[model samples]
Target: MADAAPPLQRLKGAMDAILVADVFLVMAGAAWFGVAVLCHSQKIEAPLQLFQTLWEPLFTPAIGLLMAAALLSGLLGWWQRRGQKRAPGTGS
Candidate 1:
């Protein structure tokens, strides 16, 4: 079997994947919101209901998860920086 990647490499890959996913989620969410707003403004009940029926149930939890992931990523970066600052022989 091929050797596994180093932990740092694996972490970097995971972070990259998350960043891509975040970008996609933001873009898709914005597009969805725009369409939703347009539908509502035009009094297009059928399309609006269709969009809501397909999107609303997942939207809340997805946003919550996205926000939580972003917060966690920021906090982790902060913690890593703080740790590096405190390591011996590492000049600030």
Candidate 2:
């Protein structure tokens, strides 16, 4: 079973990377939304325009990626749990 260690470590590393990306995407989206709300409430046109210029292009794709990552992470966790349940000598 020692030979299996590297692949398992790689899988964990990949999962960690994906989770980090998911978190970053969420934070970015939240920050963008907060900026938008602040801009609207403050009636700041120049900053609003600048934010829109940068955010509009990436907003939809970023949301989509965040959602996809969330789903993938959930599925991966579920799959791991299922595998663990099925492993030999592991009781319910």
Candidate 3:
């Protein structure tokens, strides 16, 4: 709408981006976890073992940070936009 404020529009875009990133993060983490588990059970080669070994420590923190950041961004964006429907006293 032409009446929409710039800040609210920006917040809405940010919230959408965060939601998409959250979905991608979950999918990637799950895929890596599944691979690690399968490789361990199948007695896979050294590279797979090496990947599993390296992945846990590095990816664990990364995934945590990704999810936390996405959630925080979504919340902050929502909060910023919640009361931003109008500039004060420009009556519709």
- lDDT per residue as tens, model 3, 29-66: 67866786787688766646665686667666667767
Cα shift from native, residue 85, model 1 (Å): 1.7
Candidate 1, superposed: residue stretches over 4 Å from native: 6-19, 89-92
RMSD of each: 3.6, 4.9, 7.2
* Highest-scoring model, TM-score: 1
| Order of candidate numbers by lDDT, starting with the best | 1, 2, 3
Runs in model 3 deviating more than 4 A are 1-44, 86-92
Mark the 10 consecutive residues where model 3 has the least summed lDDT.
Answer: 83-92
lDDT (10s digit) by residue, model 1, range 23-65: 6876787687788788889886676576577566765666776
**In model 2, where is the ten-residue run with the lowest total lDDT?**
54-63
Assess candidate 3 and give its TM-score to the true structure: 0.45
Task: Output the better candidate (1/3) by lDDT.
Answer: 1
Q: Once model 3 is optimally superposed onto the true structure by TM-score, how far is the C-alpha of residue 3 displaced, in angstroms?
A: 33
Q: Rank the candidates by TM-score, best first.
A: 1, 2, 3
Per the 3 Å backbone cut-off, how many clashing residue pairs does candidate 3 have? 0
lDDT of 2: 0.75
- What lDDT score goes with residue 44 in model 2? 66
